[model samples]
Target: MEASITFGDDALAARAAEAARELAAAGVPEALAAGDPTLWGPAAESQAADRLGWLDLPTTSRSLLPRLAELAERAREQEVEHVVLAGMGGSSLAAEVICASADVPLTVLDTTDPAQVRRVLADRPERTLVVLASKSGTTVETDAHRRLYERAFRDAGIDPATRILVVTDPGSPLEQTGIESGYTVVQADPRVGGRYSALSAFGLVPSALAGADVARLLDEAAEVRPLLALPEGNPGLELGAALGAAALAGRDKLVLDASLSATTGLPDWIEQLVAESTGKQGRGILPVAGGEPTGVPDEIVAGIATDGAVRADGPLGAQFLVWEYATAIAGRMLGVDPFDQPNVAEAKDGTARILAEAGEGPLPTGAPVLVDGPVEAYGDLPADVKDLSGALTWLLSAIPERGYLAVTAFLDREAAFEVPVPPDASFEVLTDIWAAHDAATLQGLLAVRTDRPVTFGWGPRYLHSTGQYHKGGPQDGVFLQITGDVPDDLPVPGRPYTLGRLQLAQALGDLDALRGRGRPAVRLHLTDREAGVRHLLAAAREV
Candidate 1:
């Protein structure tokens, strides 16, 4: 498929056309391509100056091809065929999409769940090459992952320098760490923001190392790069105008359906790009990914298969470029800075404070108001609401018109848990937790009760992604968070807290951040994940 976009129905198309016309008159595309930072006004000019490097990444990122090829060849020569990616948010999402769309195998470790970490460690670490990616070079999750992989390689009697590849900005702490430890470090373009780094080293390096066609990806992106600077008939501008116009018209819920695209996980990457980039300043677009939405007035489906108002059909690389361009334009229209994620650090700070306050035990949280079977419901459950179904219904009731429900899961996302099923449970939840099916199930369950869109995000991982939007964007969102008891908790190497503790802190931290922002949110802890999943599933079905 070629890289391009199609405007939606009559009203949306007209609105988009008018918005695009306004943008053309204002010289949005030209200014963006010329790296003029003043397009975003005074509030964002400084960041805009530094963050527009992505505009040229389609060509500039090609410089890394040789080094990436060398890394791939080394991995082959060393008999290290397995690729494990340890990154969060933008650091990993782009690579994750690239490898997935290319049908290559790259194990993504974007979580702090002990079971998840344990599963990664159990993989063939001896022959696994771990790509440690962190834009800030100081992310706790990436550092913990680096420590574990280092220890794992050491325990397996392998030199970590041969197995560790570091990706970060130059002069960052991770680059220094990689250099001090004799590991190869690929520094991404410092001027590129994390979410917009799809065509840069951060996205290209890991995918190249994992045997994806990095060159072809770059070629595809380059094929569509020129259109981004065009005034009219530009796919990026058209799509962005449609998005901004819709949001401005109170149809801010963006339901993305990339089923028609050649890329498998484009919607997810776009979700982060748009949500993080636009969802701020007390107003932003909310991306409802991977569902069949009815296309309510507050919702616009950006489907690839002609199923929506904004049809974004493109090859993987081109899709990334277009989405980045469109999200930037949308950010300009929405009156927010697309480059900086202002509220992302709120959850991290909360996690730190929680970890510091909790000492060695479970993160301190107020007791669950209701415990039904294996499920423990935290958050505001009305005194009269006794069952899990009732709690879910109450949360659903909190979702306002033009608002959305965000279902976040903090559990080990396994394909299948081998735990014994509880006899009293209504049914078995066999497959959702691993793929975050439980959260999705609850999302759909709650979705049917209201016309509003519902979104599902994996925990701590989302903290680096949509957590910014949840805290900083519109105040109409209602949240349902799922976290469970980690019986076999694993500790971070040389750290006081376990991965389980870190995961819990992240969950509670985000929960508090949402609550502190006056957003209605709740946490449901599964006492016995298997039984809890079963109960949660059954209760959601009832809700």
Candidate 2:
């Protein structure tokens, strides 16, 4: 019997097949034809070259190059003051990358916060240009902001079409909206996903307009392409597949995201792609990203590092303990299935509500009323909300959710009296205490403060509001520093700090400086000798 034959795009097939063979030869088992579907995909392998082949994708993204050039020219002529980018996820990531890399005066409003939107608009004049970006054009968040801006333009008696630019797929709701509104619609590449679209014009145009050397960036991306596609020798594909394989082998996968901005947005895009695409079947990877930016210089790491130190023993018993887990998270993103933690969303919602209540209205500041069970833990909690903190953590531990515990203190009677005390105000007071106690513990502690059971965060959503709180708040918090001090030391790599040490130091120091004015400070060092760190964490339950 003859084998059934499939034929179409013969040239494409041949090129992809040759590329696959090279990948296999280079040691990419995923490139090899395996019966296990988790190990490979013809579509992914097939698109490898073409995706990276674009002349413009390296410095500028494929999704936004041409339009950026046009916008730049227009800006030069129109003397445009501000460029407001609208969208979320991929739609915004590309623009963010471009703006970060560009020379233009740009601001990306990638939030659902009405106050944030009002602030951006209020900061800029009515003439500022708005770029409404959405891959599907149906994103509710983007649309909400669009409505606000559309009203602004209409009220100012400006032609909305000339002032607004829309980026979206053809035939999407956003495209229809732009068309009906008489706005210019720049169609994104139909085949490009949001994360992958960064190399497309989607990200490049805005970045270039903001003053980044987009062409050079694309050049760099292009340079990496050939290297990435080189069979087993290709670092990108090889690294990716190997990491995935390692996770599949039961090793913990962790991605140490040492980027300047902890939640700057790039990691989110990469995380999604790595997680959704690679995590197939029940046996896939478990991806995670960690940062301990407490010891290094703030400016160097975009201000993530500060004064906190990892403990000799405790939660962060050793830098390696966290490192190994980080490696596991990276592996999981690649394809390893780390034990899945549960109820992430519910925990986030509770945290949000807490923040919102504190920021918007009267907080429940009664006093620590510890009850039996989980309430007895966290000995140094305040009288007003001690139970709240313990209850939040207990609920988080009880289920699968993303929980975070923060204890802020205001030593200055004046500062404490400041209007609008947040519900978690006391939590902030303990920042240095937590950071000093155990930077790792503080990190993990925050990960467990939820009304619902929490395991870990699926993405970086919770980190968005942390920066402003760390930097802009009144000097009234001594954060507890915690870290597992096992594995002795981390490789410092030519610099004054190891990647791990740098992370821990910077994060701690910044918190220290933020509240060092008059507040008393304390640092706790959690020992990670043996399973002592976990034991301490478990002991918290008994507290």
lDDT of each: 0.85, 0.41
Strongest candidate by lDDT: 1
Q: What is the overall TM-score of model 2 with all chains considered together?
A: 0.52
| Span of 10 residues, lowest total lDDT, candidate 1 | 428-437
Q: List TM-scores for all candidates, in order.
A: 0.96, 0.52
At residue 340, give the lDDT of candidate 1: 87
* Tens-digit per-residue lDDT, 355-469, candidate 1: 9988866568788899989988888767999999999889888788767889999987652444444556443343333423344566666677777788889888888888888
Instruction: Encode model 2's per-residue lDDT on 176-246: one tens digit a residue.
Output: 98999898777766655554566555665556655666665555455544333334433333233334334
lDDT of 1: 0.85
